[model samples]
Target: MSQLKYKRILLKLSGEALAGEGGYGIDPERVHELAQKIKRVRHLDVQVAVVIGAGNIWRGQIGMRHGMDRATADYMGMLATVINALALQDALEQIGCDTRVQTAIEMKAVAEPYIRRRAIRHLEKGRIVILAAGTGNPYFTTDTAAALRAMEIDAEVLIKATKVDAVYDLDPKVNPNARRYEHLTYLDALNMRVGVMDSTALSLCMDNDLPIVVVDLWGESSIERVVLGDDIGTLISS
Candidate 1:
């Protein structure tokens, strides 16, 4: 009910979030639920771009440890992100929200290739653009891709939807005494090495002065809450 703080946002969702409780592949119910939440933000008239991770299906680095060729493994991971993007696009469209899936690697049969101008145009037209593949390169995580896309799109904020509510001094799951930060500066996170995001992603965000809000995606109305500028999670910024 409050004025929205972000007019345009890039939402970074981990592939594992789409897997839900199944632990593998896309879960239709979970995807639909997430789609509905996104719809709520659309109703708020905010332009949204999504960057989905492929770790639920495969991780290139992990595959390399098993003797798989690094490039081939990374390409496989990229394809996995495409799969997730397509699933999310379909789910969002099923609910009457316009969406597009753009991959860094060309996959004409499934979605459009990454085109910065075109993606921004889509957002301007009120379409949700989902970016797939990790920068179309090996050794880059989707977290980095999200940061890059956020900068390219000039999004007002980056909403990182994770399992946890916010960044903590330590792994909250393992360390019950870990402390949560309500707000953090980029330098603070770097100095402390908080694991909320990877170094590359953190650096990009820091350099760009992009603000980020880390929140639990599974919580009710959490996305809407964050968009409305409510104090619902950890906010990391300049």
Candidate 2:
């Protein structure tokens, strides 16, 4: 009902967001809750696309530290994202929300390969498109994939769903007096190295002048507020 500030949005979700209390693996309840939230967003007549991380199931860095080959670990992490993606797709479809899971790495038996035009077309037809796999490459984070996919889909804004409500100069948990920024330029974020997002992903968004809103993923009405231009989170742009 409110005037939408961003008609098309790419939602970047960390896999841990679906991990529930255990903090590992996909929690069905959490996935269902997320599906409901996304369904609500779609009800607003906004085209929604999602890019999900695989931290819940696997972390390439952790694997590499444990002596796994870098590329192998990264590929495993990417496959983990597909597992998350399929779980989400099932939840959405069960609730009457149409969704398509597109993977950067081809898996024709399970999902469609990532195709830019086809993805955009799905969005136009009112289906939520979920992008899984981390760019089909090693040495890249899902954040980068989200940024790249956002640009490819011509999304008006990239909504980064995080555990925290906004970007703070320091960890709010560690320092009570840490400053919270309502807005920040891409350069400022890069300089600060806030760790909210990686440099490579940030650079891609910066190069394309893509606006990013970092908001609390579980906060009540958080995503909806941002979509309606409520200015409830740390907005990074320009």
Best by lDDT: 2
Off by more than 4 A, model 1: none
Q: Per-residue CA lDDT of candidate 2, range 84-143, in tens?
A: 999999999999999999999999999999999999999999999999987999989999
Q: Which residue pairs does candidate 2 place in steric collision?
A: none
- Tell me the tens digit of each residue's lDDT in model 1 across 1-238: 5788999999999998889675677899989998999999989999999999887788778878989998899889988999999999999999999999999999898899999999999999999999998799988888899999999999989999999999999999999999999999988988888776888898899999999899998888998898888998899999
Instruction: Report model 2's TM-score to 2 decimal places.
Output: 0.98
Candidate 2's C-alpha runs over 4 A off are none
